[model samples]
Target: MRGILAGWDSLDPALRWLMRINLIALTTATLLLASAYLLGFRHTSVEIDLGVMAVSIVLMLVTPPLCRRYGAPAAIVGLTLSALIFAVGGTWATPNLSPLTALLTMVPLLVGFAYLGRRWIQVLSVVAVAGSAGVAALAEWRRTEAVSEEWWINAVVIAASLPAGVAVVVLLVRSAYARLQGQSDELVESRRRVVEVADAARRSLERDLHDGAQQRLLASSVTIERARKELRAGRHDSAAALLDQLAADNREIVTELRELARGIYPPLLTERGLVAALQSTARRSAVPVTLDVADVERTDPQVEAAAYFCILEALTNAAKHSGAAEVHVTLRGRPHLSFTVCDDGRGFDRGAVDAGGLLGMEARVAAAGGRLTLDTGPGRGTVVRGEFAP
Candidate 1:
């Protein structure tokens, strides 16, 4: 049943819906035919009615294929009318037992015609009910049957059923459409948030470069210029001391620049991949970290990057804020990629720190079509986990 439902979901919308409607009609017809047989309605007309129902089941099975070969609208309309003919004919043949049974054919018609405008739906429904009644009335007269008052009851039942079915279809379709619209709106908002966060990150990078490394480099240039001036003025000792100070300043700037660059994107991540990069990060953490990374095939670069940052942030948080004695980092590769960072520490309330590193990690994971979960308690350990698809 699960496999069948999966296969049905994989079908094109038009074909799927057509087949569904056909299936429903087929089941209803079969049950009605069985009921007539059990009631001992063994006349030739009843046999003919059963034959019509059997043909309807075949027509229902064939309609989906027809919808694929011919256009959906033409195939659906033709199939609907064909099924209606069988239903009306069968009702006419076995009026004593099949009046309400004929009305079941309209179930598929209501579903199939839902995409057509309301005006067309109303017109077609009236036509179908009228045609069925006329056929049943003609069949009654030809058999020299009396004009039973029950004809009024059958007409009223069918009339009410048709409009009610249309109303239900309209309501279901509209509700589905509204749900889809809401999902679309949410996706748009998520995308906008990602873009905003990315732009903010870019600006932060620029600001850091200007304030930290760029300014230091400019000062180093001035110091070099002073050293050259002292050397030209024949102050050898002064020039030598100035050059020594310049060397120290240069070293300091290089270290600061490296730190800044690592904050943006670790060089090891690009050079050696996620495992080596994460191992380097664990080694650098203030708290001891044990890493368990599965040796498997590499994932997509984007997925690897997102996972790397998520673990990196979690480790940094655990080391800095959690005051943990030790951290455990686990990375799984293959099938689906996932990682977890856990620390046994004085955990803080999740609501209190939901914005900073946690929010960024959540955004990154969401961008990769993944999810991030954080578990923490006041005194218990904190666990940060993320799962992703490559």
Candidate 2:
């Protein structure tokens, strides 16, 4: 059973539905037919009816592989053609009108409409409605005394067709709406995180300036006063040395400010795009880093920032926390921006994976409208993979 379902997770929505609907419809239809036979529903060709169903079931079984190989549209057309054949064949095999068989005709059209494009949906809707009316008209012309009791088959089919189409549209619209709502919530969450992180960044910047560059500047001012007095008193050599020291201090302050600015947002990430920026990071990393980056077209700065920071954070973990030697970083573009950071680090147990750094990484990815996943096990190493359409 496990082997049977091994590739099920990767199946597309249409293919998965094809499998599920086939199983469920086969089961339920079989039971309904057996019940109808026991209840003495007249059948002119029971063997032929069963033969059609048998052939359809065989075709249905082949659809999954075809769906996997050829994709959704062709598989859907195959499944629908099979259904259309069975419906016509089965109804003709019955003496009066197989009301059940007539109803089953709409299943293919509606399911196809759900999976196919808007044009296909429009085509299937017309086909279903016209087919319903035609089936009813056939029953009307063939209304003999034995079949007189099912004279309402036309009304039933017409009524069922309209409602079924409407129901499918309603369901599809609702699903699309729910997805939009989920996206809206994500945006709100992202906004909240940006606000909080921005506020924290401001405070951190203030503290760094006061503790680092500000004190150096104040000391330099006093040195300038002493240098002026020495020069005024004809101690030119000492004054010149003091001026030289002050010049070095000014250069150091400029370097410190640049580093602080880089911490907020790297200049390379904006100027050269993600791949170049990542290469820069790799060169600077203490751990031996190997990069497998494809040529990337520049994307949104925010998106590039997220990818940069995530990989940067991952590298930080590698250097400071993880007892690791080497790290591999991969990046791809075109279809969308994606990257992976893998480290030969001592991974933690899955149960104890609730570290703040990990949580921050996840939140950062989410804020950028992307998905991120972490794969790790103790002694197995850690992989942080992320993807987003920018």
Highest lDDT scorer: 2
**Model 1 C-alpha lDDT per residue in residues 1-390, reported as the tens digit of each score:** 333333333233544555565556545655665565666634555456556666766665554444333333444465566557665655565454344444544544555453444665776687667765666675566445523334543343334233433443455466557646965875786677787778778887899899988898898899889999999999999999988998898899889988887878888888788898888888888899999977444667777789998888788788778889999998876335778899999998777654656667778887776668888889998998887632
Please provide, for model 2 over 42-78, each residue's C-alpha lDDT reduced to its tens digit, 9 standing for 90 to 100. Answer: 3434445556666776666565554433445555566
The Cα error of candidate 1 at residue 323, in Å, is: 2.4
RMSD of 2: 7.7
Model 2 clash tally? 0
Instruction: Write down the RMSD of all candidates, one decimal each.
Output: 11.8, 7.7
Clashes of each: 0, 0
- Residue 242, candidate 1: Cα error in Å is 2.3
lDDT of 1: 0.66
Which regions of candidate 1 are displaced past 4 Å? Answer: 1-186
Worst 10 residues of 1 by lDDT: 156-165
